[model samples]
Each structure stands twice: as structure tokens, then as C-alpha cells.
Target: MALPYGFVKAKIVSTPQLKSTRRPHEVQYHLHFGITVNGAPWDIAVNVGTTDADDLLKYQLVFDFRHSVLTTLKSTSPGSTDLTGTDALPALDFLRSDFLAKTGAWRNSDVMDGSDQVEPVASLQRLLLRAQQSSLDVYVFGRFYSEGDGVHDVHMNQGSRGEFIHHAGDDSNDHNDIWQDGALLVDLGEPEWALYAAAFDQQYVPTDDLGNPAPGSQPIS
Candidate 1:
């Protein structure tokens, strides 16, 4: 089953809030933000990796992203719109869309939940401040909640590995798909857009048509 992928173009209404998961079954880590769509409250839950040292699939966040898809994302309308089967929207595909440069793009140090450096967290804090101060619009791509109150899974959605290869007793990896990857894009001003892409080190690329990892696929890290 394909996740109900979609996009939410709205304005940031609150600062970034860090939530630490205390349970084993909850979303391990996320940077939540308050947003409004046509006067209705909505939440943007961005995965920021986990603090667990035993977890093999750590987070990888790409900052200052550059790609031609930025041009198409600029013209998107406001509010929430489902892109499950639409060709007008730029449904992201990290491996196939040429969204990521082939060289000098991946760094061994890019992480969202590190305590040593004031990097990604610092960068995201600054982004939220600017977005709030300037009232800039943010484009969030993910699966909207069934209740229609928020959006989550704002990260790469393909090429699962290890235990992620199956879900809901479905051995076919029902959650994975192409052109339905999640992302967070912000429009700063004319000719300037902020694209943030993230994925776990375990998710590989060059997925098949059904999003299963190809025989010789490479990890996104």
C-alpha cells in the first residue's frame, strides 16, 4: 500500500520544538513545528535521527540543497494538496531525480542530533527564526495524518534495509514508493530557496519500480 503522500505549503507560525521520545514504539526523534493551513492548525514533524547508540540506521541531513526542481516548487499553491497521482508537483526521488549531486554532497559529519557541534540544529534554528520573522512560506512533502491535522515522514521514503523492508505483516515493503519521498523546502526570497533533505544511513538508492532496493544499490550516505 502506498502511503498517502502529499505536500503542504504554508507559513511557519511557531519556533522549532525538540521532542525526545521516551517510549520504544513512538517516533524516535523529531523536530516539531507549528504551522497553519488556511487558518487550521497543522504540525510539521521532521525526523532528526535518534540518540540511541545501538541503532544502526542513523540520520543524515543535507543542508543548502541545490537542484533544478526548486523552480517547479516555487509555483505551488497554498494549503494542503494531495499529489498521490499528480504530475504537476515535483515528487522527490533522491536516487532517480538528479536532486542530489554525485560528488562532494555527502559528508561523514552531517547529522541532525549531534551534541559536539552547533551545526544542523543551529542551522534549523536559524531557518525557523527567519521564516517566522519574514513570514516566509514553507513547502512540506509527506503523508498527511488521517485526522488531517498534521504531516509527518518528512524525509526519504524509499530503499529500505534491515528491519524496514516490511511493514504491517506485508513482506513487500508496502511503505516504500518512487516519487513519493518526503522533503522540506523553504522559499527565502526571489532566486533563493532552502531545500533540506534527510535519510537514514540504511536506506539505499536505485530502488526498483516498487521501491525495493536493487541488487547493487548504494546507500544514500
Candidate 2:
């Protein structure tokens, strides 16, 4: 039997430095998972893990739990161009149903409009909280363009690559033109969980040229 939705635990295992560019990247991490439905361990994987991080931009995190891939919660950034402009509000909605259906937890999730909202800090926090509640291990592998503002940073410019547009007589574009930079994988192992979460949060915390989380910086939440 599977564990109850909120009975799982989280911890960091390992941390690896990753380089991000306009390309797809993959990283593998080990985890120990313990699931209990009625105070009894139902499923335990000492090494259950996932691969791939190809959708990190549009989704804050791409998690593969027990071979099931889930797109992380996300909100639009400011200055982004969308078909419908100025009417979009960043709120947690698109993935609400999917998340609730998949993990049986919906405490934290959000969607933000890029044109109206400038930051997605609160959305990120909700995602973290939900991840904790569901006991659904997470692996984040992907890259997002930073817009210089800590709070309003993470953004992916898919249109810059002609993904969502098709011009008259244009035949060289594809819908899936987006590239993944890296991925995050979650392990039920306490150590692995902690490491993965730290890496992800650190990356989003904004850094200097040296890639260090800015000092005295409070990440938007």
C-alpha cells in the first residue's frame, strides 16, 4: 500500500554543480523512499530515481516520481509577450487538478501572469510546501532565463525561438523548440532530498557572477 499523502519525509543527499546554457542536460541522483499507507511501509526503494530535466523553463521544476513525470508549479514573469496581454493574472490553477490527482496534495501551487505579475516567489514557496506534503520525491532538471530581479527572475522565452508562432510560408520552426538545460530528481532518501532541494533553491536565490546566492538576499516567497 502507498503511504498517506502527508506522511512522507524529505532530506538532502547530494549536491552537484551544473552548468546551464541553451541546451538540454541530464543528471542522476540516488534516493531512498519509504511509503506507508497505514503506519506500515508499503513501498520502499533504496534506489528509485528518475531522469531528464527538459522542461525546467516553462515549469519551475520537472519531477519524475516513480517513473511518472510532473511539471512543477509556475507563474508568468513580467515583460513577457502573450497572445492575451494585460488580462492574465499569476495564480495557481493550470497544474492544480493534475497535482491533486497525481500526488493527492494541493497545499501549494501557483500560476502567475507575466504581463501583470513581476515575481513568482510565492508560487515557488507553495510548490516547495506541496512537495513536502505529498511525500512525492522531486527531481528538477532544466534552465530558466533570469531577468536580473531576484523576485521577478525565472522566465523562459519560448517565443524567441519561434515555438508558439508560425509565419506565412515559414517551414523551419517546430512547436517543441524549447531546450532543457538540466534536470532535478527527487529521492526519498532524506539525504538526497535535502541536497536536491538545496541545489534548486540556491539556483533560484539569484547570485553574483561567481554563482553564489546573493548575501543578505531574501528570495521572493
Candidate 3:
């Protein structure tokens, strides 16, 4: 199916900024670009920061799809009443060690526990190893839409996730931005369903190794 109105030709416009600080340890920032179906500009921003022992960073992004009439229609009124549990899309999550293992970049060392919901430590180990070897750039894209039997049906999927590392002092723009580009198309299971377009960018610190800081080690700066 064709992508929603505003997202048809979306594009990513900037590189992310990475900052090493004593307060937060690590901070990353970036942005994305697109135009709504009505031709209004769509801009999204993301920020992420992390401390030493965490395998994940605190992440946040601003998404503005208000100009998307189709999204507004589907998210409100009689259209929303038709949705069912099955119509809800899966949640999009950050990449973790388990995901890396599944992708053949590493091996799983810990038993799978459903309650943890966090990525395995092995993945963080691999990521830190890579980071130490060279600066790494990672990108992620998220697309949300509706399809099948319900009008308010929602679905989410990742376009791609990958890493590119550069030598330590290369200064070749090692920083990475995750808000590349994305598109969404809602079928609403009917011809009358409106079309919406959404484009967003996310900037966040990469997950660090999951362990306590080394004794006497200073924070990043």
C-alpha cells in the first residue's frame, strides 16, 4: 500500500550530537524532517542520556502529527470505537543484547526471563567492546499504522537497525542519528479510511555496558 500523505517523501536532515559529561555521563541529540499531507512542516527531536552501569539510556522524542487529518480521524470519534485488542500493534523497543544475538553479532550467556524486559548483558558487553575499539553509530526507524478488520487498528515496525564504527580519534563524524526516515499507511479495512503521514527523529545516548563503574573511575567528560 502507498504510504500516508505526509510521510510519502520524508527525509532525515541532521546528524546527532554526542556529549560526554560528568553530570549525565553521556548525552545525544538529533532531529528529523517531513511534510504533512496538508504541506505543513513536520519536525521531531529526540534526546538521550545515560550513566555507566545501565544497558539503556533515558530517551525522549517530540512527535507532531497534528496536521495529519487522517491520524486525527482515526485516533478520535466513531472510528476509534471500532478498534479491538487484536488491532493494537506491537510495541517498538530499543535494540538489546538478545536482539544482537539473534542477529548473529553475539551469543546469549544468560537464561531468558520474560519479566526482565531488558536486553541481555551480553549485548551491552558486545556494544561496549565495539565502542572501545571504535566509535559506533546506530540508527533506528519506527513506523506506525493501522490495517486489517478494525478502523482504529494500530501496528508498529522497525525499518532497520545497524552500527558503523570509526577509529577513536578519526574525527570523521562518528556521531550517529536514529531518526532517519519513516512512513505509515493505515488501511482501516475500508476504502473510506483516511490517509495520514508522520515523520519523526530521535536522538539518544547509546546504551553503555551494564555494570558498576570501576573503582575510582571518573565520569565521562
Top candidate (TM-score): 1
Prediction 1 TM-score vs. true: 0.81
The lowest-lDDT stretch of 10 consecutive residues in candidate 2 is 1-10
Q: TM-scores of the models, in the given order?
A: 0.81, 0.20, 0.22
1 or 2: which has the higher lDDT? 1
Off by over 4 Å in 2: 1-64, 68-138, 144-163, 166-175, 178-185, 190-221
CA lDDT, candidate 3, residue 21: 30
What lDDT is reached at residue 207 by model 1? 85
Total residue pair clashes for candidate 1: 0
Best by lDDT: 1
- lDDT (0 to 1) per candidate: 0.69, 0.25, 0.24
Worst lDDT 10-window in candidate 1: 107-116
Tens digit of lDDT per residue, candidate 3, span 93-158? 223222111222221112222222233223332332332244221122232233321111011111
